[model samples]
Target: MSIINQMLKDIDKRDKPQFGANRPKSVYLGRPLRTRRLRLILWGGVFALLAFLALSWLHERLSAPASDARPSAEQLQIQRVPVLISEPTQDAASQRADAETADASTRAEGEPEETRPRTTRGEQATVVVTDLEPTQTRAEQPVEPVEVAVSEQVQVPAQTSMPVVTPADTTVTASDDPGEMSIQRSGNGVGSADRLFQRGMDALSAGHNRNAVQRFREALLVNPDHIGSIEQLAAIQFSRGFAGEALQLLRDALERNPGASDLLLLKARIYERIDEPRAALDLLRGRQFRLPQDADLLILQGAAATELEEYTLAIASYRQLVSWRSDQGNWWLALGFSLERSGDPLNMQEAAEAYRRALQDRSLSESARNFALDRREALGY
Candidate 1:
């Protein structure tokens, strides 16, 4: 029995169980139909869901109004508004054309009608009656007949009264004689000398200086020793920058007419222009002494002193000028400039004070005030 069991066990082991080894066999079966069916169903479900979403979107788009689909309220409102159609009016164009025609007619009346604008159609313009008024024929107005009245002739007595008349003296001189000298002068009936002088003045006014000089010389020849001509010639010479010639001429004239303040002042001006401030100062000082109340001479003297860098003397002269004409702002300005240049602190302060005084004067020009202010700023005051 043990032997039989061992053989059976060997057979069972061979047929049923191997400890660690097995024979090769097919592991796979054919694909299941239900798996394919499940795959097809899943794919169909995905496609159906996609088709359903697309159809839903199409239905939403088609079902909504076009205006509601837009996001903008203004665009929706614009779409909702109705458009208006306008018809053109011919009356406006006709009125414009009529106004243009009337304006052209007025302009044509202003100019010659032959020179007026022509129509391209080559049609002659006809006069159109704009107003209807009553017209009367000349024969329709009746002519009135004239009437005459005759009266009986009557004679009246005439009386003659004898006039008291003075007897005509044969020796009496006739006052209405044409040869009688009439000493009466009329308006501006200039003599030959005055006319020549006026012509020279006109030439001077017309800027013909050389012609003016010639005319003035002729006037002097007509009336030699004419002071006006001499003085004017000297002035013109000085204005032309011939100071030496002017000085000599004026000096000669001054010899004839001494104590002429105007000539003295003119000489002083020429001297100042020539850079001879000392001489100018001397002349102005002399004039000031002669005429103590001459503010012009005092101002001139101050200017000369200022030109010479004699600030103290300038201040003194300007002070005198200010005393003479207290109302003159230019004098105060001159005094300020002089004092400012003096280099003395006290005088500089005095100059600033003088400028302030000048600013208070109503006659001071804006340029003058600005200049004074500029000077004050420059002095660091």
Candidate 2:
């Protein structure tokens, strides 16, 4: 500090008194910068920038494999399908001996209970890493075992080397593969209706009418269109004096199968017994067109028409019956009986001719022949 002060005093003394305004002014000129020093600073900044970029690149490369090796927790959860994992098969005696030995060792060595592997009843699954690049860095390899312990998991039977069996009566399956599950009912269309029908028949033959009824009803439940089952059930109902119930049963069946011949005939008989002959006629009106050769339907239709004094309809039915079965004396007698009651002189003449045909039938009963003979005598033929 004293040296700088001495220099300053020497300069002050040399500037002895400048009393004149003509003293030269010290003009300011900027000092030039040192290019060498500036070059060194700029090179230092470039090296620092390059070093930063290289460090960042190395960091990203090191972290890439770690990211690829360990999947996210959410990904692992989604990939895990709950399944039962079975332990090795060990005999009971050997397992108990090993367990006792482990307990003794644990007690002697003061081993913590928690340090031993646990036996969990919870369902487990095996996770296998897949779909990775061939190259793997040692640092990226897993340091711990991949063991997932989920509290809530689906429980299933632990499978061994056994074939998987599908559920019963569940033949339906689905897949994205073509030519699989081609038809919905491809595997299960054979029902038990026939078997049930046979069971019902056995019961009926054994005089177990009530049991037979129940069996037939069960068969009908499985297959509503089971003709044999419905027929038997209807017969049982009508015979048991449940004419109304039988009628209802038959009507429900007819609703599904309007042209079912056996069901229609049974329904007509029920209607007649319940004093609904008009309903019977209406039910059987157009049925003849479809079942012209049905003998039971024709006989029932004829009887219903006669009860309602629909002699014309009755005569038509009997005429068709006689045409199909010329030797049926009852059918011939029915034709003559319907013709005589038609209240037409021309019909009376036809009645005599029909009665003559009835007498010619050897199959006619004694009473039926006598009735035909009296009708012919009264017709004055």
Top-TM-score structure, candidate number: 2
Per-residue lDDT, model 2, residue 170, is 31
Best by lDDT: 2
Kindly state the number of residue pairs that clash in model 2: 0
Where is model 2 more than 4 Å wrong at Cα?
A: 1-190, 289-293
- Candidate 1 TM-score to native: 0.42
What digit string (tens of lDDT, one per residue) describes model 2 on residues 1-381? 999999999887767665334565545222234666788899999999999999999999999998788444333322222221212332344334444544554473464545544434444544433332223332243222223343333233433444444332234544332212322332332256666789989999999988888888778766778888888888898898888778788888888888788888778777787788999899888654434547888888899899889999999999888888787778878888999899888888878888888888887889998999988898897
Worst 10-residue lDDT window, candidate 2: 78-87
Alpha-carbon shift of residue 328 in model 2 (angstroms): 1.7
lDDT measured at residue 198 in model 2 versus the true structure, 0 to 100: 90
**What does candidate 2 score on TM?**
0.51
Encode model 1's per-residue lDDT on 1-381: one tens digit a residue.
Answer: 999999999898787756334654444334576678999999999999999999999998888887565344222211011111111221344334434544554464477545644332222222222221223332233222111111122112223343433222112232332322223233322244455678888999999889989987876666555666777888899888788889998787678776666677777878877878898887666343433645567678778788889887788877876766677788898899988888888887888878877877898999998998898887776
Clashing residue pairs in candidate 2 (N, C-alpha, C atoms within 3 angstroms): none
lDDT of each: 0.64, 0.69
- Report the error of model 2 at residue 191, Å: 2.8
